[model samples]
Target chain A: MTANARPILETERYRLRILTPADATPRYLGWLNDPQVTRYLESRHRPNGLDDIRAYITSHDGHAGFLLGIFTKTGEHVGNYSMRIDLPNAVGTLGVMIGDRDHWGRDVVLETRAAMLHYAFETLRLHKVCGACLSTNLPAIYNYRRQGWAHEGIRREQAIGDGGSRVDVVMFGMLARDWRQRREMEQEK
Target chain B: MSAAKEVLAQAFDVSITEVPDDAGMETFTPWDSLGHLKVIAAIEEKIGRDLNTEEVLAVIDLASIEKLIAGVHRV
Candidate 1:
């Protein structure tokens, strides 16, 4: 957590590090092009190429915020987590995609989210952290609700979904105090 | 499931043994929106307070309900 040092995070079973242009591989491109993997993500709106992925990764060089690669202990890259901050508001917006179908339903989301929340609140010391998902994504909606994130509101028919159907965007928010309270409660358990 | 079996079983109107380990929105057939709220209400009654968003979300299924009302199943 030292200043000016590269941030590399490790949980019990996963290691998360910033993704660079070199990290963009055909497999990563495959994920962006996979409808099943990107179903609930905004990325599904358009196709992506290797150059696009590289540029996206290059844009977040950790100057302010960066894209994190979610990796297994065995060095397999399964997904991506992006963090963007509004310094004036001291708020962060997180976007995630578990591209690897093999890792679905395996608690990777829960584990990685805990790590990112800690980094967001404890390390970054941000005032708030939030994420949004399409309303049609039942599993994500269920996760956000179960995680106790405040349902800020929903943007009705925010975007188009598969088959040209419109979908609402649901937002969830968590404040610094709320994070502390949740942690304290976890300790009491 | 010992802690909240009666509550879940009663809400779903089934025997306690009928509740499976993976009973959730996706797995449990009866766990629709109404059933979810029912479980939430029962958990609230057991805890003696209304569930906050976080607590409500934690009670996704039978095991979560047991965890929410911990110590009831341990004994």
Candidate 2:
């Protein structure tokens, strides 16, 4: 999709940009409000309104964290990639949300991770990027492995699912070295 | 019926031609969570046994599946 002048990262089919306060639209608020959309996200626990969205967007200035909007070539905001950086440790924890139902199962999250991981390791010079998902979120678990993150460990019975069942959190990590090797492997292929 | 790629292609409802040389769960569109479960069941049906959670998760790629099938046949 055609991107704005400043994109944090660009993939084959996505433009990742830091979201602005004005980018907080009613549709975005609806995604957070929709249980089907936010079921796996902690944000699902609370209802998010325009003001909250705007405030959160502004809070991230690309230094401490980024509220990046993933846009299609046609300029539709289908999802977001959120990265929270720990300056002292040089680690970033990332999460993805494909708000648009139409984009589900389309491998958007996979591409988003590839682009953002490059940014985190190369641009930001972060030492590592990590993410965790609920054990029951099988798609996410497979993505973490497919994306080349080491399955660091699991926090047993860490969280409760919507069904009121305890679910473990699977931790994943990728160091700068791992990212380099992955890129090298891609080049070799 | 005994080929790893064939089993995966069948489980994912795709043709063997579509699968990559270094085939893995990520490379295919239908190889998601549900597809993963189907792959496990398909493999079990071919091997004529059930797989444990560990064995199921270890089916990371086509090569791994091939190795698992070979090991089962050896036994």
Candidate 3:
């Protein structure tokens, strides 16, 4: 399915939509290239042109699950949350990038993540959703933890960042059963 | 309910003699990363509803916790 074909999800403050070719611009591409943003990510190559971004977006599946563009109430694009499904493995990996530095500590990620987790467990029917963050990135780890993911140990010196430097990667995961139980409790209240 | 209170106490490791308004993430020590998960699990066991991760996060406090419990029955 095309990216737009997937149903849109809206929280009280954000509207998550699918990304399109129209979003591939120098302004958006610059965020992907920023060393600070890409530091924890596996890819180091910045998009050389729109063709690269378009290829990436079009290749994604909107039906099974894919990237989302997070927007504010006023319609500004804030960040993105994407889930890649591994059906055979019965799990998905969640990745988010808040392009706007201004919204970093505002709980937007928490809300966005919560929304995605809901979608993953209820709609996707996945067994688990997992995330990995660089050990040095305490905020990300802290965010993931606060949202109910369990610390699953670290990969010692497994990440290769810019300049060929090594960094430990912390893994976190949440089971669908755990997620459902958490939702159930919230309902009881 | 006494059971709810007991679960809250066990999950947060706090007395929570009464569900206080100020009773939030900042009030208790165990009300932390691991504690949040424990509390979610506790509530699930107590109420019998399976919460999604977002639902767990949305119930950020005792009041929302109560509301969530009530909402589940309507569904």
The pairs that clash in candidate 1 are A148-B54
lDDT tens digits, residue span A10-59, model 3: 88899988888887777667767777766766545444567887786776
User: Per-residue lDDT tens digits of candidate 2, residues B1-75?
Assistant: 238988887787788887777777867667875576678778888788875434554678888788778775242
- What is residue B21's positional error in candidate 2, in angstroms? 9.3
Worst 10 residues of 1 chain A by lDDT: A1-10
> B1-75 in candidate 3: lDDT tens per residue?
445466677676677585455455545444654356576777787678766433554445566566566665233
Candidate 2's error at B20, in angstroms? 8.8
Q: Report candidate 1's interface RMSD in Å.
A: 7.4
List clashing residue pairs in candidate 2: A1-A73
Docking class of 2: acceptable
Highest lDDT among the candidates is held by which one? Answer: 2
Question: Could you give candidate 2's per-residue lDDT for residues A1-189 as a string of tens digits?
Answer: 112324567789988888998889988988998888888889877668999999888877667778899999888999898888888999999988889988877778888889888888877888999999876666677778777888887787888887887867878899999889988998999
* Alpha-carbon lDDT, every model: 0.77, 0.80, 0.70
Q: Quick one: ranking by lDDT, best first?
A: 2, 1, 3
Q: Better model by DockQ, 1 or 3?
A: 1
Counting clashing residue pairs in each candidate, in order, gives 1, 1, 22
Fraction of native contacts under 8 Å reproduced by each candidate: 0.07, 0.24, 0.03
Candidate 1 clash figure, as a count: 1
Once superposed on the true structure, which residue ranges of model 1 sit more than 4 Å away at CA?
A: A1-5, B1-75
Off by over 4 Å in 3: A1-5, A45-48, A63-65, A187-189, B1-75
Best by TM-score: 2
